[model samples]
Target: DMNDIPPVFTTVPRPITLDDDVPIGTTVINLVAQDSDGTSPNNQ
Candidate 1:
């Protein structure tokens, strides 16, 4: 639909406190985005 909404962040990462000695390549958090449209391309 032309009025289709944009993808939203279904899973947002939370703030975290890391030590100064933490590894440089350490992963902080993960995020997820989802589209409500039920059609192809748009759903991706």
Candidate 2:
């Protein structure tokens, strides 16, 4: 998985309220990221 990610990405803390209660087996990642490619990733 590390090889699939870029090295120039930066991320900061950004928390969001749960849209809905997740199931027991669910996995979630809540983060705000900024990439050198000029795209912004939100609440991932």
Highest TM-score model number: 1
Local accuracy of candidate 2 as per-residue lDDT tens digits, 1-44: 12334534356655756657677766566455543433334212
- Alpha-carbon lDDT, every model: 0.82, 0.47
User: Which tens-of-lDDT digit does each residue in 1-44 have in candidate 1?
Assistant: 45388989988767889999999989878789888888877787
Q: State TM-scores per candidate.
A: 0.50, 0.28
- For candidate 2, give the lDDT: 0.47
| CA displacement after TM-score superposition, residue 10 of candidate 2 (Å) | 2.7
Whole-model alpha-carbon lDDT for candidate 1: 0.82
Q: Which has the greatest lDDT?
A: 1
Q: What would the C-alpha RMSD of candidate 2 be, to one decimal place?
A: 9.1
Clashes by residue pair, model 2: none
Q: RMSD in angstroms, all models?
A: 3.2, 9.1
